[model samples]
Target: MKIGLVCPYSLGTPGGVQNHVRDLAEALLARGHQVSVLAPVDDNEAPPYVVSAGHAVGVPYNGSVARVTFGPRTAARVRSWLADGAFDVVHVHEPMTPSASIIALWAGDGPFVATFHTWQVRSRAMSAAAGLLRPALEKLDARIAVSENARSMMVQHIGGEAVVIPNGLYTKRFAGRIRPDWQGSDGTISFLGRMDEPRKGLGVLLSAVPRLVAERPGLKVLVAGTGQADDVRRSLPSSCRDNVLFLGEIDDAARADMLTGSDVYVAPHLGGESFGIVLLEAMAAGAPVLASDLAAFRQVLDGGRLGELFEPGNATALADQALRLLGSIDERDKLRATGLSAVLRYDWDALIDEILAVYDLVAR
Candidate 1:
C-alpha cells in the first residue's frame, strides 16, 4: 500500500505530532508499505521519505507557540504533492490547525483521513471558523482522534465523531542501553519539555524543589528542554539552586539514557496535554513515572496503577509524592515493572494494524 502522511508542525522542531508522523511512516515502511510524509521543516535535514512543504512561523496556540505553515504558496505545494504522489490513502494530523494538514484537506482529491491530536476545553478560533472548515472536512473518508479528550474536542467544536486511536511510540528505541553518566546517583528526578512554556510547569517543579532538597540534601533535578537556563535557575531558591542541573536540549538517545538513570520521571504539567507521549517513553526506559492528575495523564497512567499522580499545580503535593517515590525503592520498582508491561500496548507494532485498517477502509 502507498501512503501519504501530512504533519502540520515543522519537522525540524521536536513536537508530539511531528514525531508521531515520522514514527508512523517508518513503521509503515518497515512493514513493506510505501510511505511519504509532507511537513514544514526548518534548518534540520529530514529523512528521505519526507517532502518539505516549506518553513513555518510561530503562532500563539493552545498555551504554547505553534510553528505552522499556510497561505497560497503552501496550498499550491500541497496540491502538487497530492497530485504527484497519487497515494492510496492520505492521513493528515491536526487538520484544524491553520497549517499544511488543513491545506492538504482543501487541495487534495482522494481518500482522506484526518487525525485530531489537540484537546482544549474551548477554542474560539475553531468556533469562529466552523462554517469555513466544514466543507473541507466533509472530504475526509475517516477521522481519528489520539485520545478521548481529542475526540471530545472534535464533537464539541466540529459537530462530528472521531474514532479514538492513541498515539504510537517506538518503545524499543527508548528501551536500549543506558548511559552511565546520565544515571542519577543519590536521588534524581528527570523532567523534559519546553522550560520556558508555563504549561510545561517548570515553575511548579521549581517551587517544590526546595522541599525536595531539604528532605534529601543530595537530591539532583535534571531539567532538559529549550529555555533560558539562567532564568530557570534564578527562579529557584538560592539554597536549592545547586541541586538542579539544566541540560539545554537533548537528542532522543540522551533522553532515553536520562530516563534510564533517573530514580523518577516527573511531569508536573499544568494543562494543555492531550496525550503524554513522554510518559510512555519514560515507562519504556524503565523509569518510574510521577505526573499531574490531568484527565489525559490519568488515562496514560491507568488511574495511577501503572505510575503515580498528584494534584495539578500543587507544589506541596508534587514535593510530597516525589519524596515518597524517591524514598521507597519497592514502590519505584513496582511502578517500573507495571509501566513496562502497560507501555507495550502503545507500541507501533500493536497500533499499526489499527491505523492500516482505517486506511484500508477509507481507500476502499
Candidate 2:
C-alpha cells in the first residue's frame, strides 16, 4: 500500500518521532510498499524543509533559543502532495503541533491511520490545540498508541478505542560493531535523549553520576542528543568533566554504535516518558538497560526482566543502583541476553505488519 506519513515535527533531525517515522518508512519500503514522509527537515539529512527549532530549557543552542517553524511554502508542498492523492493510506504521527499534520487532516483524500506517541502533557496552547484536533483524529480510519499511557490519553480526548502498537527499531543497526570513540575511560554508561525537558531527568541523572563515580572511579558517562548540552556541562562538577562527554545530535547509525560500545544505558526520565524508544535501541544494541521507575518504562522493560530499575529522581538511589549494577557483570550479561531475546518482538517488519493489521481492522 502507498502510505503518506504526515508528521509536523522536523525530521532528518535527532528525535524520537523522526527516527520512528524514518525507520517505519524504510521498513515498509523494504516490504514493497510505497511510503512518503511529510515532516519539516531540521537537520542535514536527505529531505530538506523548514528547520522547526525546538524548546529551550536553561541554555541556548546555536544562535537561537529554540522554536519549530513551518511556514506557508512548506504547507504548499504538503497540500500539493495531498491533492495528488498519490497515497493509498495516510499515516500521521504526533497529531499535534506545527500545523502541517492538522492541515493534512483536511487536505489528504485517503484512508488515515495515526499513532499518538505522547501522553497528554503540554502547554495550554498545545493541549487546547489537541482538544480541537482530537475530533479530526477520531475520523481517521485507524488509530494506534505507542504505549498504554498514550492509549489512555487518546481515549480521554478522541473518544475511541485505540490499539497499542509500540514503536520499533531496525535490529541490525544496534547489532553492529562498537564505535571507537564511544569506548569510555574505564567503564562507561550512557544516556540518550533531548535533555531540555525535565521529564528527561538529566538533572536527576547528573545528580546520580557524581555519586556513582565516587564509589566506582572508572565510571564515565556519555550523553548524546539534541538539547541544551550547556546546562548539563555547567552543572557537572569539575571532577566529573572528563568523564562526561556531550555529543550533540547524532544520526541513527552513530547512536547505535555508541549503544553497542557502552557498558550500560541509562534513561532516568522522571515523568512524561510515555514510551522509552531509546531503551529499545539500547536493548537492540545488546547493552544492558537502566531506566525510570515509571509504569510505561516497566511495560517497555517487561517488568525489569530485561533491564535494571532505579528510582526516578533520587540521585543517591540511582548512584547506588548504578554501582550495584556495574558490580554485577554476570547479571548485566544475563540482562543483555534477556534484552537481546525480547528485542526480537520489536523488529520493524513485524511492527509495520501489525500497524497494517490495525489499518485493515479500522478500514473494515
Candidate 3:
C-alpha cells in the first residue's frame, strides 16, 4: 500500500501530532508498505520519506504554540504534492487546522481519513465556525479520534461520531535504551513537556519540587523538554534550586534513557490532553507513573491501576503522592511491573493491523 501521512505542525519540533505522524509512517514502512509524510519543515533536516511543504510559523493555539504553515505558497505546494504522490490513502492529523493536512483534504481527490487529536475546551470561535467547517469535515472517508474525550469534543463541536483509535507507541525503542551516564544516584522524578506551557502544568510540578526534595534528601527533579531553562531555574526557591536539572531539550534516545533511569515519571498536565502518549512512553521505559487526575489521563492510566494519580495543579497533593511513591521501593517496583505489562497494548505491532483495517475500509 502507498500511504501518505499529512501533519499540520512542523516536523522539526517535539510535539504530539508530529511525533505520531512520523512514528506511524515508520511503522507502515517497516510493514512493507510505501509511506510518505507531508509536513512543515523548520530547522530540522527532512528525511527521505518526508516531503517538506513549507516552513511553519509558531502560533499560540489550544494553550501551546503550534508551528503551522499557511498562506498561498504553502497551499500551492500541498496541491502539487497531493497530485504527484498518487497515494492509496491520505491520513491527515488535525484535519481541520489550516496547514498541509487541511490543504490536502481540500485539494486531493482520493480517499482520505482525519484523526482528531484535541479535546478542545469550549471556545465561542469554534462554535461559531462549526457550520462553515462541517462540509469539509464530513468529506473525510473515515474520521478517528485518539481518545473518547476527543470523540466527544468532535461530536459536540462538529456533530459526528468518530471511530476511536488510540495512538500507537514504539515500545521496543524504549525498552532497552539505558544510558548509564544519564542515570542519577538519587531518586529522580522526571517531567517531559514544555515548561512554559501552562496546560502541561510544569509550574505545578515546580511548586511540588521544593517540598519533595526537602522531605526526601538527594531527590532530583529532571525537567527534560523545550523551554527557557534559566527562567525556570531563577523562579525556583533558592534552597531546592540545585535539586532541579533542566535538560532544556533532549533527543529521543536521551528521553528514553531518562524515563528508563528515573524512579518516577510525572505528567502534571492540568487539562486538554486528548491522549497520554508520553505517559505510555514512560510506562514502556519502566518508569512508575504519576499523573494528574484528568479524564484523558484516567483513560490511559486505567483509573490508576497501573500507576498513581493526584489532583491536578495542587502542589501539596502532587508532592505528597511523589514523596509516598519515592519512599517505598516495593510499591515503585509494583507500579513499574504493572505499567510495563499494560503498555504493550500500545506497541505498533499490536496496533498496525487496526490502522491498516481503517485504510482498507476507506480505500475500498
RMSD (Å) per prediction: 1.2, 4.2, 1.4
lDDT of each: 0.90, 0.73, 0.87
lDDT, residue 311, model 3: 93
Candidate 3's residue-wise lDDT over 155-183, tens digit each? 88988688898998989788655555555
- Higher-lDDT candidate of 1 and 3: 1
Could you tell which candidate, 1 or 2, scores higher by lDDT?
A: 1
Q: How many pairs collide in each candidate, listed in order?
A: 0, 2, 0
279 in model 2: Cα distance from truth in Å? 0.3
Please identify which of the two predictions, 2 or 3, would achieve the higher TM-score against the true structure: 3
Flag regions of model 2 displaced more than 4 Å. Answer: 47-75, 121-131, 179-181, 184-186, 227-231, 361-364
Candidates 2 and 3: which is better by lDDT? 3
lDDT of 1 by residue, 79-112 (tens): 9999999999999999888999989988888699
Q: Which residue pairs collide in model 3, if any?
A: none
Better of 1 and 2 by TM-score: 1
